[model samples]
Target: MRLTRTILAFALLAAVAPIALAQSQVEITSDVFVMNEAARQAEFEGNVMVVHPNVTVWAPKVVATYGEGGTTDIRTFEASGGNVRLKTADQDATGERAVFTPGDQLLRLTGNVKVTNASGTVDASELVVNLETNVSTFTSTGGGRVTGIFTSQ
Candidate 1:
């Protein structure tokens, strides 16, 4: 069966308005950055790393899609391959691929997703996180349940 997923752009814009307004200048570096003005898309390949105020993303490739034809108007991001890692504050997470939709204030991590912090680690096949609400949901791709291990001092 073919399933269609739809997300409203404006809704995403509204959901992420707070983050957009409070964001600081973003710095990105990679072996290659491919920008397409006409398509309003940018792709960073080969050890792509993005540094923002409180967030850092590292991946083999990262893609940004924009609504307007400018880099400042990024709507969403996809970090893929090379065990994508995302770090913010005291949290660190790794996955095969991660999709962050600022507009929706949502981050989706897939393929052996693992999240860790000072406490412990949570592992699952898929993880969805809401940046605004600070909530997360994890689902296993197979019949197995999500797992977590916490250590206390």
Candidate 2:
């Protein structure tokens, strides 16, 4: 149970950490909002969006779990089943699925992952962003090469 809670904390924090480290209120909206208090989970379907001061996430579906019986404290979230987008003021990432865990300090993006910023764009089959160290690693193993277009320093 403690591990689950820790994972939840990591996962949800990973999603927003790229934007900033400070804690802020996050707002999520969708066509359907279903909460299961018994399970401490929520399901948002159809045009699901998680919005913050400097960051925004959009997907067709998002599954979130809360911690410590707190409805507002989302410990973890997974977005899937479409072009899942994580956008900040300058950077943008899109993938088929996105999973974040801040406690573990890992952010995973898979399936046609593309990350773009003013500097350039990177394409990979999978992307792992280390939230703790602010490092990113991209890989592709399915005969698809990791491609990137880099601009000036």
Question: What RMSD does each model have against the real structure?
Answer: 8.8, 6.3
Model 2 Cα shift for residue 53 (angstroms): 1.6
Alpha carbon lDDT of each predicted model: 0.75, 0.77
Q: How many residue pairs clash in each candidate?
A: 1, 7
Candidates in order, TM-scores: namely 0.81, 0.80
TM-score, structure 1 vs. true: 0.81
The sequence of per-residue lDDT tens digits that candidate 1 reaches over residues 1-153 is 112111332222223223323645567778986655567666779988877777788999987777863454668788898589989898998999988886788889999989999999999999998988989999997787899999997
Q: Write the per-residue lDDT of candidate 2 for residues 47-147, one digit (tens) a residue.
A: 98888887789999988766784644656668898689999898999999988764576778899999999999999999998877989999997798999
Itemize residue pairs with steric clashes in candidate 2: 8-75, 10-101, 10-102, 10-103, 11-100, 11-101, 11-102
Model 1 ranges with Cα > 4 A deviation: 1-21
